[model samples]
Target: MPELDAEKLKENALTSIRLGIEDFQRSKLEKDQGGDPARALSAVRNLFAGILLLFKYKIAVSVDATGDASVLIFNPPEVLPQADGKGGIEWKPVGKFKRTTIDVATIKKRFEGFGIDVDWPTIDKLQECRNHLEHLHPANTLGEVADFVAELFPVLREFILTQLNEQPADLLDTAWPVMLAHHEFFRDTIAECQASWAAAGVPEMMQPWLESCQCEECGSSLLRPSQQDIEEGASVDNQDNTFKYVCVACGHSDLIAPLMIKELNDAYYDDPRDGGEADVEECNECKRSTFLISEQHCLWCGAELDYPTCTFCEEPLRQEDQFNGGLCGYHLHAYEKAMRDD
Candidate 1:
């Protein structure tokens, strides 16, 4: 194995420090101390730079470890040896080349090869923030900029520490207590209810989106499907082909079709299908399976579909375009009213 290049690591590490110190000072002196919205642009850019630098450091380490010209840089496959001579192929370097410059996409692809996922949403948000701030982000105040900056540090820190085998104390240790306090502040606000969930027996997977499934009146957890609707035949499993979630605390009921439910009479073993991805088209309004392609109407809600417009109201329906389905709320009500009067 080639010896790890201390010189290469040192160069990147030093650059990360130089950029980080300046980034920290701008956030503190300009944004925090002066409270200048004018400084918000520079401050946010600094935060982005620092975060990217940390990521760059991790990438440098990966390059040193493999030393494969093809794998690390843009060198050809002939320069890279294929077999590890064991069970797997290794990216072994046979020929030498100068280090290639890397950008965000390059670094992202590198980590992905190690089975690490890039958080595209977070990255997209920051890039958008940067673009907008240069053109103008909607939130330009010191606090607004600071909040955006604060949110990203923890995410980057976690990634660096987890994947790079580095400690915050050895890296950005000074920011540790601040991040801890930031968590605590949020715990007292948005996360307070979440902390108590484990004691209340709430599943962890559901915690992130718990607000969406909460009872509007009583604030009770409602992630589990309602047995009441099932037993009452309001949403019978086979007949209605729907799933219902009823709030136990306030009796608020919501129904969604098991539009994803599939039945295969024969040859399911030979030919497979994904019910959720293949056949299901959720409604834009209620987020349900009422978007049946053939029916052109939501049977449960009587919503007017995209295929047919309401004659009286002339309301346009919105549907998953590929499914070519839609429903107009106004016409459905009008038709139901006219039927009742008759």
Candidate 2:
């Protein structure tokens, strides 16, 4: 069997760290836009979770200031060794070999063996972010913190992609199983959030509103499986068919369409097919709140709703007014005058 490519493994580990940062940034954005701050904070914590995974693989190292001086920490996985006969020599397990004062030179040498370049500036930036997260509570604005995370994601992603691409086909194939596991873990987390939102009685219209406003990966729109789902050992295939929303871009199963009150109204009163009750509900983005009426104003905002252009003058209307009907009183006379010339 071919030996594992240490370099590729290192890259994959680092890439996971970067993806965690991206997840954090997305969560931060959702919080800024009036979504759940608790969920966003959880995403930030998951970044450290990713770091712990990387540490297990020896791809990255971490240092913490416990009291005053800095201390390097290792979190390698545990390994069992075969017992030797005479006086049974015990092998040093991976986890027990914690080096408080890690030799930076030695760590660099190991990383170099895996063909990873450890530049001071890059390391410094990563350290800065980690320090801010660890020590400072309100070090920067949410936007600023998010921007810092955004800056790190692509760099880490590219490095991992390159490492994967450089590896032999077999090595690359070996990584697929681990990658799939990670994706499933993230997907499950999303499902848990969805269950929470559903229980909270969040409106269905508001679900799409959240989707449009937040990142798809770390967005509140992504549903999380409930505690019941976990306890029942619910498999993905057994999820409620009506609850699934397939992604248009990546074809991922993440979102669940909520049952809206408006939809029920349309079903009984409007559409007779499924028996023709209202076949479709109102548009989520426009907040129509009812069936579309021809040449009528917005039901909620009372703005004149028009299609394409003004009905009289055939000129494009301002976006704010277009949904309402034509324009306001100011543009009405102008449109009428233009029609007279025609």
Candidate 3:
């Protein structure tokens, strides 16, 4: 078998990286000119793959065990010492047909074992977004995808220059400019979004939800409250019906309740289609499914639920049992039995 040395691994990594960068450049250009958002999806996938390969390349270079690169192979077989004591623990692939490299999780653990300082969380974020894109993504997620790459670019640059001892200019070439431009654009837009959110005077408790909120129509997360309305004596109280938001990217407008409830449900609950239960219950006052059971309040109509006490027994009943007309479970059952007998 031809040897897969560190240099060979480096070449493969560069190839993947270059391809990813070219895709990213095209994606950015397309986005600027109002092209397909799916373009960024390809870039995200390629970039994530290339980043993993770069990490593997570094790990391969660091393995100095008698020039054996079997450590890079996934589930490398171990050769125990023979009876004659000729061989110690050695790594070899179990199957001759195909050899798979270590996966991302394994690579992360290996880096930890080797005391390599990689920004794993950042990488994980990219991987998460990539996975999301592969399954289901919004129509215009170019900004979000760019944000992921922008966050990881500096880390990749540092690793290439300092850890791998390779100049990014030589390796990345034209891709470098594309990465920098997108990064700068991401930073500037993020700053603008932050400023708009900050100036809107959204309550502290609602800030987290707003940060994660995406425009359902356009799939953009660049949503901000209507600051002009807020300035003109509008209230954003959780129960307030006057608050409105606008998606800066798509110019889509919506009321705070619908937007927040959707975000809250998405963040908290799994998909019911996949056997997930709804997190929020129906609000008694507004009759909307925005009553947060935990918080004991309606996100839509702002109804603070007060569980009624059982009329006969004078015991506090849970919200779910409220349908029994102020009766606890036992009392409700007893009343039903009494009614049957009568």
Candidate 4:
């Protein structure tokens, strides 16, 4: 049997005992407040038991009373064999004694090896809670502590299993039920946050910014009223005629005016033609409304005009060669000459 390093063993026993007492006190408070005090008590008892086991394995042990209860301490046993012909018992001070601190970076690296993205923010939050638990007097209530543990245990257990190369199901026999309850609480909190944000009217910048915008759901912009039309105080011509702007994206629709249909159409298909430019053509049949272009056939009887003719020059004009400003080039020159003679 290897002799234990007395100082190191003593420190380990002391630290575990202190932690156990703290857990015991916390458990008592929780029990007083209708919490599962048994679990907390059990954790503390396990801590002590683990310490006693180290003592049985030839680690150092001692006792002290600092707070309200006596503390049992156990140090780590050394495993190296003796150099002399003496029995395999050797004691050599390894290093300075210090409380066992969790190697966070090491644990994180191990978790990464298992392909789990470590949620740093959550880890930070849990660490903050742990610090609060250790330092704060009249420590957090049972509900608060349990809530913290509930949030932390899943992540911790995951990390532990990954490090140990154990299947999660195998570890779940010890940690699953608590984790499920904790996850439920986590989900509820997230839902509440989402609802609160929604109720607060969190602006959706992605929504289209047109007054006559189509209903996100239906893709029909027919019922939407233009901002200009609405400002003009126009009413729908038929009250019974219901129209809706249907959204193509979300299938949402909004009831709007028939006027909105025209406005949206105009807005969507704006004519690129300049506002002041007037296209003029002459009609061979009547010669009236000479300033009007036969957009489709003849303006008089709707007969398809062969093509536009010059009103002043009385010459047939090709579609592309039609006169601008109501006169062909020759007639424009003649008009200028007549004006000069006058």
Q: What are the clash counts of all predictions, listed in order? A: 7, 26, 0, 18
TM-score of candidate 4 versus the correct structure, residues matched by position: 0.30
* Worst window of 10 by summed lDDT in candidate 4: 66-75
lDDT (C-alpha, whole model) for all candidates: 0.48, 0.42, 0.70, 0.41
- Estimate the overall C-alpha local distance difference test score of candidate 4: 0.41
Q: What is candidate 2's lDDT per residue for 199-248, written digit by digit as tens?
A: 43334334443333222332222334344544555433224333344432
Assess the local accuracy of residue 76 in candidate 4 as a C-alpha lDDT between 0 and 100.
28
253-330: candidate 1 lDDT, tens digit per residue: 554223112211111223235433322345465454434444454433445553655445545444643242233565
C-alpha RMSD by candidate, in order:
15.6, 21.6, 6.0, 25.2
Once fitted onto the true fold, the runs of candidate 3 whose alpha carbons sit more than 4 angstroms away are: 30-38, 74-94, 135-141, 154-173, 199-203, 226-257, 271-276, 285-288, 295-317, 322-328, 331-342
Tens-digit lDDT track of model 4 for 1-342: 223344554446445544543454446454457534444434434343433332322212221322111111222233454555565566564543333422344334433543545556766665555554444333223333444545555654564354335564453343445445645765565454334323222113211223333333322222223333344443333221442333322334455433333333343343447454334333354342222343533323333444366776767654334435456678767888999999
Kindly state the number of residue pairs that clash in model 2.
26
Alpha-carbon runs more than 4 Å astray in model 1? 1-35, 63-100, 137-143, 192-342
